[model samples]
Target: MKGLSWLSRLAGGLVRLEGRKFTSLKRCQDDHFLTPSKGESALYIHIPFCRQPCLYCSFHRYQFHEDIARRYFRNLRTEIDLYLDRGFRFAHIYLGGGTPTVMMDELASLLSHLKSRLGGAVISLETNPSDITSKNIALLKELGVGRLSVGVQSFNDRLLKAMGRTSHTGVEAQEKVRLAQGNFETLNIDILYNLPDQPPEVFRNDIAMVRELEVDQVTFYPLMPPLNRGDPLPPSLKPDNRCEGLFYKMILEEMYDGGYQPSTAWCFSRGRMMIDEYIVDYGDYIAVGCGAVGFFGGGLYANTFSLDRYSHMLEKGGLPVALFRGLSRSEASRYRLLTTLFGMGIRGDGFPRRFGDSPSNGIQSLVGLLQFLGVVECDGEELRVTAGGMMVVSRMMREFFSALNRLREYCLRYGI
Candidate 1:
């Protein structure tokens, strides 16, 4: 384990350098790049309106506005129509937010409309602790939401207050977790660790809460605040690597002890769990809401972060893509490999079917290097991250998302 730890850190350093290069922004060389195809891809709808923007959040979200939200819903339906008209089929929907459950009525209407198009599909929605009322929970279940993930950053009142997220007390957070529990196929509690000056015990208590509540799934995220060029970094978000590592180790230990298996590097659950992370599950997806990003047809495309621009573009009957970066064959394959590893393994036997030829044909060096360093091993035709390599994969995935978050910052800032 110690040797794997050292190699993982070394791999993290190398991956960080590659991530920086891979995520560097390029001008939108092609505005008319989207070409709808008859492929299966998940749909991600961004709810840009939030009741309140957390101090540490930089995702595309606005202070909630009722009238604007109503219009946004209408425009969102139109945006979905644009893709459907082109024969693009999506059977999985992941709703991310400002807060998807804030305007429940409109959200339900929107989901109904999406179901009409897809002829019914699984839906996963993200919500805040404050929105976990019996009414909202019931309404979401009625809307056929298979997964409900509540963001409860911490169970410690002091940490919640320190993070400026005391809108709900620690007690309220726990009650909400129980309230939302058992209502969906998978109830996921989103926890944050490596918080600035956060003690290891706080995370231990969080794991305890998960076990006590018997929540279906838990996602523990290491704090990965995007470095903004214009905005000064917040003092409260300075995360320590040692703390993160310790907390993750504790999480793996506790979850496994409790019979929770890892569904992803950061996500653990007792049984089948609905995952909202589209990347880990799908190689390509279409993001429909403002401030969302999509990867399809060998390119990474982002929708406009500006609500007005988004609605206007849909008003004019056009896709809301503001920028795009086309990926080469190598970039695409390596991306697939990374996300596959993040999900715990790469099925080598199916490599020819998914990417043509074999794993050795494109990213051979990467697979070999991982094996060479004991970071991963081949189980017949499947390659999986070793116990020691989870953190290494986590670091790499975190850096990749950090890079995308930087892209999100640009989109949010310039309203692109």
Candidate 2:
């Protein structure tokens, strides 16, 4: 029995060692880029309530219930007060969620609290097309909201139904965009491509629609499978490689023809470039609400994903933080790289200045390869993704991830 107990202890030790190794590897890969010398402060508020969950969405969202929302908002106010006491100053505020508009009163209260704490800040809110009414638009304008990111997904009714979106139709979406333009300085539309049963021609038509709408910016994201393994995928959409590649290419061509520039791997813009400016300048932000992640003061943290838990935490005078990680210098660097690549699509020559050391050979080689593929072109010293490359930005990001993974595996195997 003693021998058996000793064996069990040995097994436990091995398991712990493996876990530590894995964590270390992940940390190293995450921190491979340079940390910003001066970090920006941004606020993000997550509204977990949604009218209904879209089939492909896995974000932490709940169905609209006034009682639940009211409780959540009360807790959120408490959380904000706690942060303000901690001396956190934020410049950018983002309200995102299942549907932020669903909790209009709560949103107003939260914004009021934020204004009291931070004074003047660049406030942005993301909402579904269905939620944007004239009243909501008026409220947003009155709140001094500078940006509105509307989730339009697609203009085609068939495609929208296939994607299981309960929001506005294509026509309704256009009207909302028109309404939003009158108030917000930056109006952004979020569109998705490679949807189930979406044809190549649909993308071309969508681009035309975007051009006609003449909004400030457009974000084009490819369809990502729902994170829940048990959720059944649509019959028209499979994880097939060829179908995805073709659709991606078609979307890229259409976007380029419409004169939309790539701001991130999955985002594009037209008039005023908000994302590019943020990434390049390292704009500060604050993130609030359930499952919303925030970076400030050289640390990254996320709120609790559970609504009940989050509310309880707030009531107890604690931030609804389920996970918190203070980034080491190396970890901050890697995050910057990932953010820069995904956000701005610009490879700056001033890597050593931003990060601490020169760019790794692996990253340089990847850039070179991308350049060779005609996906990126060298403008003087700056590396910019070309139109062709923008189509497969997700694939490119995967390639970066692959390299990071390899590095991690090597570190684990050799105990580095």
Candidate 3:
């Protein structure tokens, strides 16, 4: 246990160092991403408006304004057309917050445009618990949304209040879940764990409530607060990394005991289901909205986080991409390994097809180190995470997300 603790700290430090390299981005050129990708890619559309933003969130989001939101949706469509003109194709689409369902009319218009242009692509969307009304659910189903993820956070009213989530109470969230249970192909409920002032019994009861609800899937996210000043979460609501392993262990026992299986490190399901996090399914995704980030063709890029700049760029007939960073072969390889492992494991053969080299040739030493630590095991050409490695990977991913929040804070602060 001591050794695992040491490794977690070591991994966190290394990931933070790598994150610095990631955040140091350069000006993007139009020609850099013109060429079409080689494999299946998803489209991620960000809707950065929320009626009531959560205190624990660091996503790029603005307060709700109907006129501004309507204009933003128009600009968003223009950005999508830019990608379509570039010969990019997306069969899977994910719509993420700040509360994508805040405006039903705008959402319907956007969905109609996407279906017409993209041809019945499978759509996954996220919403707050308060937005799961009958009218909203009917519209989502009509729009052909196959997966709906509700950001429930927790079912304890005390925890909800502590997290500064006034959107819905414990019973209200459960009722919303009940309302949307069988309407979609997969209904995923998002829960946060290891929050400050959250007790073990609170988390335990939350998991038990999730099982009682019997939703299609449950995603338990470890709370990852921002790494800089002006954090959204108060000090009282900050996550305690020391308790993360304990929470994760409880998750493993309860979910498995409840007849649930892992679709990823953080997501558990009863059967085959679409997950909310698009990163787990598509290695390369095109992000096409203000504050959206994309990984493509060995480079990472982010659209302008400033809504004014984003609209201006689009209105002038240009993409809203503000920064791009071309990663080294080693860096790209490590990224693939990290995401794939987070989805549970990766086949060895996939490395060659994606990286143009075998796993041993590109990341053998890293894999070997993980193997030596008994965190992962290799059987012939297949590598998988061990039971002990789940928490390690969880911690590693938390650090990575914290790095992203740092980038988000930086961009929002400077209007980049």
- Computed on alpha carbons, the lDDT of every model, listed in order, comes to 0.80, 0.64, 0.85
In model 3, pairs of residues that clash are none
Tens digits of per-residue lDDT for model 3 on 104-196?
999999999989888888899999999999999999999999999999999999989988899899999999999999999999999999898
Cα deviation of 361, candidate 3, in Å: 5.6
TM-score of each: 0.94, 0.78, 0.95
Error of 1 at 370 (Å): 0.7
Comparing candidate 2 with candidate 3, which one achieves the higher lDDT? 3
Per-candidate clash tally: 0, 19, 0
lDDT of 1 by residue, 1-416 (tens): 54556665676677677666665546463555566666678889889887877777757677898999999999999998888887788878899987898898899898888777677688898999999888888888888899889999888998887777857888999999988877888788889888885788877898898899898888988888743546666677777665567777888889999989877889888966545578888888989888788888887887777888888988988888777777778888888888888888766595555566655446777787888877688776677888778888888887777777877876666657
- What TM-score should be assigned to candidate 3? 0.95
Task: Say which prediction, candidate 1 or candidate 2, comes out ahead on lDDT.
Answer: 1
Clashing pairs in 1: none
Candidate 2: segments with Cα more than 4 A from true spot: 1-40, 229-231, 236-241, 276-286, 295-300, 325-331, 345-350, 357-381, 396-416
| Model 1 CA deviation exceeding 4 Å by range | 25-33, 226-233, 273-276, 358-361
For candidate 2, give the lDDT of residue 249.
Answer: 61
Q: Which of the two candidates, 2 or 3, achieves a greater TM-score against the reference?
A: 3
Tell me, by lDDT, which candidate is best.
Answer: 3
